[model samples]
Target: MNKSTYITAENPMSATFRYLAISIMFMFVGFLFGKLFVPASLVYAANIFVVILIVGLLIFSLMSRKNVIPTSFSMNFVYLFTFVDGILMYPILTYYLYDLGTSLFINIVLSTCVIFAVFAFISHKKPAGYFIGLGNILLTSLMVLLAMTIVNIFFNAPVFNILVSAFGIILFSAYILYDVSTLKHYIESGRITCKNDLSIHVLNLYLDFVNILLDLLRIVSDLKD
Candidate 1:
């Protein structure tokens, strides 16, 4: 309910990961609820709603970053944001689950977990400075990726899309390292003294994992086609 409830000096990493795990569980629940209860006809509306939620979360995050919002409030917002994200993923889940089959879908989920764990472990073992220094380079690459994505929207070339997906995977993988390392540094340096500080890192890792999974799915689907 508050900073002291979740985080402590003795085991900050444990507490952060515990919260992250819970957020992932909420996401799965949202995904199942969407798949079973929500109609596919609402997919377009869901997408629009998700975009609005994203924008709202961005604003909320900025306010929280400035220490204007309470840690407890921000923590609740993280769960809500992740749940909405899971609901938004319903269409993608349906495509992989129904169209690609259960086995392949399971494989994709397992692969995503494996990839996420590997990078997280790598970041843990390295010096925080190693990943912190990569911040600007990664940001610049992301901008370029965004530009290419926008161009591909107009051209819509199959090969170009494949290239973009590949780039996205690499970029987001690096992001996982950067995010994890940065958070580790924050925890060590006493920068993350409250629950509110963890919210952004949780969201960052969530986005990184999901983006990698989606991009991997795109690449595999393209290869199969």
Candidate 2:
């Protein structure tokens, strides 16, 4: 339950499980939110909500950089908001899950693969933290996601869509492991001390849940069809 317990390297197994549990819980909340608001207007509401959340995250990150804000509160907010972002992203992904086909799915998979590859490369060199290459990775990932989304407008392939959902499950699950491991490593090594470190831990849990939920959703969708 404590944030510190979630990132201690000395207890990776426990931490990993805890991290996964956190992800699962948040994912369920996201799913519930999606289910409760199942309507055309949900998409618009989600879009506006995500936009505001992103703006707030940006503003906080900016202020924190200047050391103008309290680290504890700022970091806690970061963790909380990032969790919300991760939860909200599910609806957006859900909206597109069945709408995209093979080509677009392939594009999304390839894009994600490239992002992981880049993250792997950067981490090998730095092996310190995601923040080191966060800006570049985030930008490139967004570009690829946008490109894939745009291409979907031209071609909608059901087979590919299913595959994308499957891959998303795998990719995001692996990310969960990696994120949890690194977080634990950081804590054990005395790299992370402040509560702000919780932001990154929470973010990792959020991504894990998102992908796991996507995988589950895809399975359900397939069974239904």
Candidate 3:
């Protein structure tokens, strides 16, 4: 194979895997820092700043130089996002970690990995566009769920809470499928340039993984209670 072809085709899946690993590692790093070093108040304040900064950085990166970002700068953004995210999640993770124990956290991690692997395999085998329709449906469901969540804050509906968690589990699982499917399509179609915009997919998968784990944790904790 020519150098360019090899560069493009040689283990496209590697990008996906690398991004996933980095994401998980950063998440853990953030989790530890948040849990041990940062207070809730500081994390809350930093949360707002980090989120805006990360989003702005991502947008700028995508818009510049054929959608390619400098590795150094991109890495910095990734680290910052994870560190801040960890800090933000510390309070919630602390609650569940204490109530549910570390074992449950491990279980959720393993479970999410397996589930994502299965979907990745499917995405590799299946053609793209298959999940687009389902993704749209899930997106709509997510929107309504968000609305309901806002309402629940004031209404404090127990049933609605369980329903949201259940639906969140399903929605995020489908998101994994959609994202993997989308990733495969973009890689093949030359839209995503796995080398350049891999961060985009990484962020997408990380969000899916975290959301699924959180929802699963919620359901399991409720059942245990």
TM-score per candidate, chains pooled: 0.82, 0.47, 0.77
Candidate 1, 44-141: lDDT as tens digits: 45423432433343344334334465533476777887788788777666665665678997898899999999999999898865698888787777
Kindly state the number of residue pairs that clash in model 2: 2
State the displacement of the C-alpha of residue 56, model 1, in Å, after optimal TM-score superposition: 12
Score residue 104 of candidate 2 by CA lDDT.
57
* Candidate 2 colliding pairs: 101-157, 102-160
Write down the lDDT of every candidate, Cα atoms only: 0.72, 0.48, 0.64
How would the candidate models be sorted by lDDT, starting from the highest? 1, 3, 2
Error of 2 at 20 (Å): 7.9
Which candidate do you rate higher for TM-score, 2 or 3?
3
The candidates, ranked best first by TM-score, are 1, 3, 2
Q: Give the lowest summed-lDDT range of ten residues in model 1.
A: 46-55
Worst 10 residues of 3 by lDDT: 57-66
Per-residue CA lDDT of candidate 2, range 1-225, in tens? 455564443354344345445554554565566556656566545533433433343343334333465433444354345446555665555454444555554455455445544543444344445443343443344344334434443554556555545555554444544554466557557655544544555544444444444444444445446
Error of 2 at 105 (Å): 23
Judge candidate 1 against the unseen true structure and give its global Cα lDDT, from 0 to 1.
Answer: 0.72
